[model samples]
Target: MKKLVLFLTVALMALPLKVKADEGMWFLMFIERLNHRDMQKMGLQLTAEEIYSINNNSLKDAIVQFDGGCTAEIISKEGLILTNHHCGYDKIAELSTPQDDILTNGFWAKSKAEERAPKNISVRFFVRMDDVTKRILGVTNPNMTEAEREKAIKAEIAKIEQENNEGGKYTVSVRPFFQGNEYYYFVYQDFEDVRLVGTPPNAIGKFGGDTDNWEWPRHTGDFSLFRVYTDKDGNPAPYSPDNIPMSPKHHLPVATSGIKEGDFSMILGYPGRTNRWMPAQGIEQNVSFAYPAWVEGSRLGMDVMKKYMDQNDEVRLNYASKYASVANYWKNRQGMIDALKAHKTVEKKTKEEKDFNKWANKKENKATYGKVIEDINAYYAATNEKSRHDNYLMTILRTSDMGALPYSLGSAFSQYMEASPEQRAEMKPYLVNGINESYATLALPLEQEMLAKQLQLYATKSTGFDIAPYVKEIGSKSNNDFTAYINNAFANSIFASEEKAMAFLENPNADVLNNDELFKLSSDLIRQYNTVPENVKTLQNDYQKSYRLLVDGLRKANPDKKYYPDANSTLRLTYGKVIDLPRGNKVNDAAENWYTTLQGTIAKHKAGDEEFEVPQRLIDLYNNKDFGTYADENGVLHVNFLTDHDITGGNSGSPVLNGKGELIGLAFDGNIEAMAGDVIYDPKLQRTINVDVRYILFIIDKYAGATNLIEEMTLVK
Candidate 1:
C-alpha cells in the first residue's frame, strides 16, 4: 500500500503543478484563459481585454522596454516616461562631468525644451504578440538533428516575421519559450529619441546605496523621468531637432489613494530570463562553480575601480555606473548561492526529476520520454566537469571589461587581416571608431592593474594553460612579476594609444599585427579560449533537445494541469498584493513593515555618510511633516513598499498597478531571501520591493520643484 502511494506521487510528476497566484510570470495574451479568474478574485477591476488587447488601446500599450533591459511606463499622452533611477544610471553617469555633475547634484528641466537629449537611449513598445508554436513545430520533428530542426524553425520564423511586419515598420522577434516546446512572435515599435527629463540627486536616487540594496524597509526614491519623441506623424524615428513628443495610444494614471496590506497589484514588463525548469545538476553546477567565479571576478574588478574612483572625481564619474553594475550582480550571485542552498533547491529539483523518471518509465509513456531524464543528467555531468575552467575564463574575459580590450581590438584586427582589400577599406573606419570609443573609457593605469590581477589569479587558479604561452613569456621577461610586463605591454602597444591605433589603421598590414605582442597574445587567447569550450556547446544543444522533449512529454501526460512559459525577455504579467513579509521567515528576523515613510528615511540618516545622508530640504520637509497631498490618511509620507509580484532582473522599473489598472509604484528589486527566484519560485518568502508612487510625487513636486513635469501626469485620487 505504501509503495502504491509512492508510485502515485511519482506518476503525478507528469502532471502540471498548480501555480500560486503570485508565482508565475504569465504571458499577457493568456491572462483570460490562465489567470484572469484568480486575478479578479484578488480584486482586479480591469478585464483581461482591458489589460492586454491588440485591437484597442490597453494597459500593455503604456508599458515600454526601457533601453533594451529594464521596463518603463508611459504616464501621460505627451509620452512622459517613468522608470527606475538605476535604469538611467549609465546615461546619467555618461552625461556627467566634473564641471556639470548632474549625477551628483541632480537635474530637472523646467520645460520640455530644457530637457537633456542623450544620444542612443531608446524605448520600445510592445505592439503585439502571437503564439507561433504550431507554425514553428510543424516544420520539423524529433527525427531531425538539433541543428537541422533549429534551421527549419528559423526559416519558418523568418517567413512569419516577414509576413507580420506590415512593411517593416515594426521590430519583430520570434522567441522560443518552455525550453523550445513553444514559440511566440512579438512586434515592437522602437522610439530612439528618449530624453532625460528629471532625476533626484544620487543621495535620494540611490539612498541606501549597496547597503540597503535588496533589503525590505527601503527608502530609495528610485525613479527617473524621460520623454519619448517621434516624427511629426507620431511614428518612431531617430533623434532629430524637429521631432515632437509622442502621443501614445495609452497611458497609466497615477494612483494617489495609497495601498493597504493586501491590495491587488500587477507588474507588466519584459522579464529577462528565468530557469525554473533547470535540473538539479544545473543548479548545483551554478551554485558550486559558475556563480562563485563570477562573484570573485566582479569583486576584484570593483575593488580596482573603486580605488581609482575614490581618488579622482573624473574617474569616479566614469566608473560609477560600471562599478554599480558589477557590484549589483556580484552580490546578487552570492545571495542566490546562499538562498538556493538554504532552500535545498537542488534536493527539491532532484526529487522532481526522480519522480519524472518514474513517470517516464511507465509502460504507456516509455518510448519518447524514456531517456529524457537520463539524457539531461548525462549532458549536465559532462558539462559540469569543465564548468570551473569555462566559468573562470569567461569571467575574466567577459566580466573584467578593461582586461578584455586586447581580445576585442584583436578580433577587429584579425577580421581586417582576413578581409579582402575592398572589404578592409570599408571596415577600416569602423575599426578606428571602435578603438577611439574604447580609449575614451579605458584608463591605462587601471586597466594594467586589472589585467595583471586577473592574470595572476587565472595562472594560480584555472587549470587550462591556453594563456600560458603569453603568461610564460611575460613572466620570463619580467622575472616572474606581471606588473612590469603589463606596464611595458601597455606603454608600447598601439591599443593603448589613440594616435598609434589610428596611424596603424591608416596603412594597416597583417604583418604588423602578427609582430605586435598584445595582438598576438589576444589572438592566441581568443583561439585557445574558443577551442576549449567547443564541446560544451554541443552538450548544451543536446540538453536543449532533451529538455524540450521532457516538457512536451510532461504536458501530454497530464492534460489536466496548466503551465506558463518561463520568462525570456518577453512581456509578462505577474499579479499579487502589497504585503509585508512575516518576521523570521527570512534569514534576517527584522520586523519589516508593508511600507516605509519619510520618517524612516530621517531615522536612517547619518551626518556625512554617502549612503545615509539626506538632503537638507528633505530633512526640513520631514521635520515639519510637510509632505503635501502626497501623504496618506495618517499624514505620514510613504517612501517604499513591498509586494509579492513575481519579478526578476529585467523587471526593474516595471510598473506596479492597482486593481483599476492605475499605476501605484515601480518594481525595482526582489528581497535577498528570494534571490533564488530565477531557479526556484519561493511563493512564501519572495517579496518585490517598490518605490511608492506617493513618494515619487512628493519628490517630484516638493523636493525637485518639477511641477511642470508633474502637470503632465494623469493622476487619480
Candidate 2:
C-alpha cells in the first residue's frame, strides 16, 4: 500500500511541469511548484506566497464561497463583499415587499443599521487545504468492492475532518480529485451574519433577461454588495445587533486602471462542477438522453410560473428565485445540447478513449485496464433510456414545491403525529415553522399548473419506464389529462393551503394524511424515484470502480500532458488574457471591441420592456456623462468585458484580478459559443464574461449615490 501511494504521488509530481495559458482550474497548494514561473512570465507581479500563504495575509483570504453556491470577494477593510447580482438574487427577493420592492427599485444601505441579513445565507472563508490521498488510500485494498471502498473512505474522512476542524470552529470537507484517485481536505470558517448592502434594479442587474443570457457583448450591471459581520472579537456569530462589521485579514484593492484585449487576467473562485474527464459514452448519455428531458421539463415549469408571476407582484416575489433558477438551467441545457453536438464532443472523446484502449491492451497493463472501457461503455449504454426517464420525473421534484413536500414536510408531520405527547410538544413548533416557511414561497395556483403539466409531460415522455403508480392511476381516471385530477387533489388535500395545514396540525390524524391525494402522489413519486433494480445497482458499482481506474490509468499512460483535476466547488485559480470574439452580427457593436459600454446599452433600451427597460436615472446619468472617474481613458464607461479564463457555474461572482492581484471585474457569465465548457475546455471559443469594476463603482457612486460604500474601499488610482 505504501509503495502504491508513493508511486502515484511520484507520478503526479513527475508529470511535465507545464501550465496551459487559459485552460486549467489549478490547486493553490501546488501553484508555486507547477505554475509560478509560467505565471510570472505572462505578467504576474505577485509572488506565489502572496497569493496563497497560510502564515501571512494573502489573496485567498479575500475570496469566499458565497452562500455555498457562488463565489464572493472581500473588497473593503470592513469586510464588504462584492458578488454577482444574480448570486444575491434570492436574498434580495426575500428582503423585498411590494411596498419596498428592492428587487425592482434597487437598494443601498446608507448605514450599517439598515443592512438586512437574510436567513440561512452565510459566507465561508477558506482557511487552508492539504493533500489526504495517502491517508484515504491506506485503508483499502485493490480487491475491495466499490461499495466497500467507499465505506472505508467515509470512515477515514470522518476521522480526518474531526482532526482538522479545530473543535467545530471550521467546516471541513474531504473532496475527491482525479475521480477519487487523489483526495484533499479543505478547511473553511463560516460567517453566518452576512448582510445585504446594495444592489441595482432588475432592469440593470438582469438587463438582457432570458433572451440575452449566455450571449456576449453584454451590458448587464451584474454586481451586488454585502458585508460579513462577526462578534466584537471577529469570531463567527449569528445575526445580532451587537455584531460588528468584520475586519478581514485581507481585502482586494479596486483597480481603476482599465483592461484591454490580450492583457493578463486571473480568476480565483469555487467553481461548482465539471466533467472534463468524462468518457465518450457518458457524453452521449447527457447530450442525447438526459439534457433534452431536463430542458423540456424546465421550460414547462418556467412557462407556468411566469404566467402567474406576471399577474401579481406577490407571486412574482415568491417565485422569482425559483423561476430564475429553472430558466437559467433551461437555456443552459439547451445550449449544451447544441454546443456539444456542434463541437462533436462525443466524437472527440471517442477518439481519445480509443487511443487509451490501445495503450491499455498491452500485456503488462492488460490485467488492470482491460475491462475498464468496456464496463463504462456498457453501463452508459444500458442506462441511456432510464436516464431520460429519470430526468423527467426529477425535474418535477426540482421545480414544484408541492411535488417534494410529501417526502419532506409531509413525512415529518407523519412522524410528529406518531410521537409521544412529550415528543410531539417538542416537535410541534418546528413542524409549524417548517410549514410556514414552505408556504411562504408556495404559490398554489402556479404549483398546481406546474405539477399538472409536468405530470402530463412525464406520462407521455417517459416511454420505457413505469412512472409512479399513483400518477398512472390518476392519468387513467382522467383520460391521460392530469389537470382535473390535480385540481381536485389541490382542492381537497390539507397540504394545499396554510389554513388547512394549521387545522390539521392542531388535531393530527395519520389516516387523513394517508388518504390525502397529494400526499399519496408525492409519496408514490418519491418511492419510484428511489427504487433501483438489483442489476442496475451492481452495474453502478462496477462502473464506479472502472471509472476511477480509468482516470488513474490515463495519468500513468500519459506522462507529458499537463493534467489538472476537474472543478468540484473548491477554491481554484485560472489565469488567462482578456480576449475577444468576432461580433458576427449577433451583437450591435464594433467588430473588434471586446467590451460593451453605456452607449450600446442605451441603444437596446425599450420603454415598458421587461428585459430592456432602462431606469430613467441611469439614462439621465449617461446623458449627463456622469461616469465620474470610473470611465476608461477613452471617456466611455465599460459595462462588461471578456477574458479567456476557464470557469463554470459556481465561478459567478469570482473576482477577476489583474497582474497585481487588484480587482478589475466580477466574473458572471460565459459565452454561448462555449456552453460545452463544463465538459471540455475550448481555447479558441470559451470566454468568461465579467462585469467591469469601473461599472460597479459607477453604479454605486454615480448612479445609485452610495458613496458610503466607495469610501470604504481601497482604490488604485
What TM-score would every model get versus the actual structure?
0.94, 0.97
In model 2, which regions exceed 4 Å deviation? 1-19, 588-591
Q: Let me know the TM-score candidate 2 reaches against the reference structure.
A: 0.97
Report the number of backbone clashes for model 2: 0
- lDDT, candidate 2, residue 122? 96
For model 1, residues 84-103, the per-residue Cα lDDT tens digits are 99999889888889999999
The residue ranges of model 1 lying beyond 4 angstroms of the native Cα positions read: 1-16, 414-428, 464-481, 532-538, 585-592
lDDT of 2 by residue, 406-438 (tens): 667678988998899999999999988988888
- lDDT, candidate 2, at 650: 89
Q: Global lDDT for candidate 2?
A: 0.88
Look at candidate 1 and tell me the lDDT of residue 419: 90
